[model samples]
Target: MNKLPYIFSLVVLLSTSFGPSSAQAQERRGWSPQAKGAVIGAGSGAVLGAVINKRNRAVGGVVGGVAGGAVGYGVGKHIDNKQKERARIAAANRAAAARNAEYRRSLARRNARQTVAPTRLQPAAMPGNSLVAGSAAMAYDAQGNPVPYASNAAYLPNDAYGDASHPYSTSEYRRKSW
Candidate 1:
């Protein structure tokens, strides 16, 4: 009969201690390692203490539970901190990798632009021909095909050199004989 009351008290204590904590843990998401450790430590400590101290089980259980819970919490907290540090390092590496990839892409684009051949608007030189002051120069399109000079309109007045009455005529020199 005395043992029955002791058993009942133990059961009630365990239920009250762990039930609400477990429920709260579940509601928040899941049991953190610390919470899981604490629950396991407390239960195991109580069992061990009850077995060890036959005369005063309750006092032994309380002392054991506190000591076990403290150790469990420390270990759990250490593990959690290590995991968080690892996650932080992983995130930093990922960010650096992304930045490096972006920099490479931008570098490739700049190199591609620089390496492409530029389009020529005018010929560097004409084979077997010399440039004349009043003549339209040959030009080239992007495809290397011959095209009219962009300044051809400026040379159009030179065509009137053939007519003596033109303002740029050399008739006065012809009449001077020198």
Candidate 2:
């Protein structure tokens, strides 16, 4: 059984060596611009022989050189095309990242603006500013001192509804109402 396997391997090697198909040749040999140029040169040399000279060596050489030059140019063009595509993709990626960063920055700014209160936009109101000052002419006693009256009270009593220690409520000042 081992001898049979060895025989099979030898047969495969021989088949590969003698293979007529270009695909097989391509697999065995790597594809390159230099190799393609050599093949084109050989083919052009054979085709141009009869027309240029009966002996044809000079014409064949010239034709082969031209074909090789063309093949080399084509290889160079293929390489340049690949490089251009890669450059375009890199530029597009950069543009997309810039746009995304700008969007995030704007969103962050908007969110910060929303979080802060607009305290400076409106005027502050005070609790006692609206109350009229009492006239001393109406309330003066015989000694010329102003008489104390119940109307002079700044606020009505809240009774026992609020905390005993915190007798004044801030809500009345905030709204500026007695």
User: For residue 6, what is the lDDT in candidate 2?
Assistant: 59
Tens digits of per-residue lDDT for model 2 on 1-178?
7479659967997998686766654546565645565556555654564346557665665665566566655765676678789999999999999999999999999998865432222222323533545431224444455443333445443443455465464333212254
RMSD of every candidate to native, in Å, equals 20.4, 22.6
Candidate 1 lDDT, 26-138, residue by residue in tens? 54677788887787777788778877888998888887788778777877888889989999999999999999999999999999886554556543444333334544456
| lDDT value, candidate 2, whole model | 0.57
Best by lDDT: 1
- The 10-residue segment of model 2 with minimum total lDDT is 117-126
C-alpha lDDT score of every prediction, in listed order:
0.69, 0.57
User: Which residue ranges in model 2 land beyond 4 Å of their true spot?
Assistant: 1-55, 116-178
Give the Cα error of residue 174 in candidate 2, in Å. 45
